[model samples]
Target: MKTLWIKLLLWGYAVFSMAPLLVMLLSSFRPTADIFDDPLGLPTGPDLGNYAKAWTEASFSTYVVNSLIVVVSAVLLGAAVSLLAAYPLGRRRFAGRGLFAAYFISGMTLPAHLGVLPLFYLLESLGLIDSLLGLILVYAAGSIPFNVFVLTAFFRQLPYELDEAASLDGAGPLATFWHVMLPLVRPAIATVIVFQFVPLWNDFFYPLVLMRDESKLTLPVGLTHFFGEFQNDWGTLFAGLVMTTIPLVVLFVLATRQIVAGLTAGMNR
Candidate 1:
């Protein structure tokens, strides 16, 4: 009875969470007057005009390109740094290992919002403000803490015997890490990639504060511009939201199995 009750509760929560998404999707095809008349009502039929209008008016093309650049660059840079840094501590262990790990992990406790002024001043001095490269650096630096923490723990699980064999065959540290240890933590890498990419893709805080150019705006910021310009255009607004949301859903679906494995398997080790 208790198990069944728990299952029922979970299902109910799932429905509650999905309700808004369902409404938003329906509203995307609806007319502005219809949305106000009955916001919950279903649209008359499938209408793609909202997407076209939103795309043309919102400069979604530029936003997509900018988002892709930042997200891809950040993910690659963050993952590489995290993997290299974590491998030494997790696999090889040295003096001050614990201190180094704690130092990296400490970044998690320091919220980015608190250092906005200092970061802005520093970036301004370097002339990196309002540039996509600057945004990528910020995103990569922000991701280090969590990725290092998780990947470090995950790397600790990889068998020591593998390392022994690699070393015995005259493998150098870099080659061993590249050819051996890295592949073993693919799930963790995927998990961190998905986690970091989702937030960065939807991120508005850093973009709003750091960037001034409309041409360099990401999807989330672009949606803000769309909303500000089309305050009463519910259909187009929802369409823009739908566009922003689809990528997240697709990413989650693609990486769901790896994410589950990483979350479940890492901590226990």
Candidate 2:
């Protein structure tokens, strides 16, 4: 009876969570009048026309490309920087290493609003305002602390003998990191990528704050163009939302198992 109840609870929660997504998916196929007439009704069929209308009318082609560029560049460069920074703390017992680790971890706790003023001023001075490269740098900064923490914790679980073996093979610290430690931390890397990429791809805050140009806007902010103060295009808007959600849905569907394993792999260590 208890096992049955647990399964029932899981299934119940799953339906509750999925109901909104199902509604949105069904509504994306609907004409605007159908949505107003029967908002919760099953879609008559897949309306491929809505997607084309949203993509071409809303300039999503440009927004999608912009989001992809920012997400890829920030994640790759941020991963490289975080890995290098994690090495000393993961493998060594140098002075103040605990304090140093704490410092990096503290970045996670710091309120984003506090730094916004200084960051904006600095970027302004550097003439990076309204620039995608500027947004990439900001996203990378936000990602590093958690990424470093995860990578370092994962690295610490490795056998110290690996470091010794590499040292024995004429590997210096950089060579050791590049050839030995990094290759072993692949799961953690994937975990970080999945976690970090999702938010950066969907980020609206920094892009809204730093960018004033429409051509430079990422998808999250760009989606606002479909709304007006008095009226909203319900059909096109839903279509746009469905399009925005597809990449993330596909990403998780493909990698959900890997993400779960990577996240839980070092818990026992």
Candidate 3:
């Protein structure tokens, strides 16, 4: 009886969580009048025109491209740099290594928004404001501490014998890292990618503050254009939202196993 009650509770929670998403999905297929008339009702038929309007009329294609470029570049660059930093901190015992590790980890505690004033001025001086490059740099730098923290744990869990074996095979440090160590951390890399990609893709604050050009605005910022002072385009806005959400859904579905593996990599150790 207890087990059955628990199962029932879980199913109820799942339905509660999924209800909004189902409403959004169904509303994307509806017209503005239909959505306002029956917000929770199903669409009479699938209206492909909402997607077309969102893609073309709303300039989501450009926003999507900008988001992809910024998020992908930041994630890859941050991962590479963090991997190099983490390996040494995790596996080596050099002078001041503990201090360096602490310094990197300290970033996790400091909120990025707290430094907005200094960062804004710094970017202005560098003439990087309103630029995709600026956004990429900010995101990449922001992600480093967390990436290093997680990857360091994974690296520490790895056996030292692997490094010794690589050295015996005449593999230099760089070669060993690239060929052997890197491959072993593939799960962690995917985990970082998924984790970093979602926030960067959805981030509206930085893009809204930094980007002045409509053509350069990311999807999150661009979606606000759907709202008017007196009214909102609920149907088309839902369509745009669906498009924004699809990528995240697909990514989680594909990388779920790898993400789990990465998170649990060092638990038994």
The runs of at least 3 residues in candidate 2 whose Cα sits more than 4 Å from the true structure, single-residue gaps closed, are 229-232
* lDDT digits (tens) for residues 1-269 of candidate 2: 99999999999999999999888888888888888998899878878777788788778878888888888899988998998889889998899999989999999998776899899999999999999999889888889999999989988999999999999999998899989988788888888988999988888889999999998999988877655511355677777788888888987887787778777886776
Give the lDDT of residue 180 in candidate 2: 90
Cα deviation of 25, candidate 3, in Å: 0.6
* Residues 134-244 of candidate 3: C-alpha lDDT, one tens digit per residue: 999999999999999989988888899998999999998889889988999989999999999999999999999889999999988887765441147788888888999
Error of 2 at 215 (Å): 0.8
Write down the worst ten-residue block by lDDT for model 3. Answer: 223-232
Model 3 TM-score relative to the real fold: 0.94
Deviation in angstroms for 35 in model 3? 1.7
Q: What TM-score would each prediction reach against the true structure?
A: 0.93, 0.91, 0.94
Residue 236, model 2: lDDT of: 74
lDDT of 3: 0.90
* Clash pairs detected, candidate 3: none
Better of 1 and 2 by TM-score: 1
Kindly report which residue pairs in candidate 2 clash with one another.
Answer: none
Cα lDDT, model 3, residue 136 = 97
Which portions of model 3 show Cα errors greater than 4 Å? 1-5, 229-231
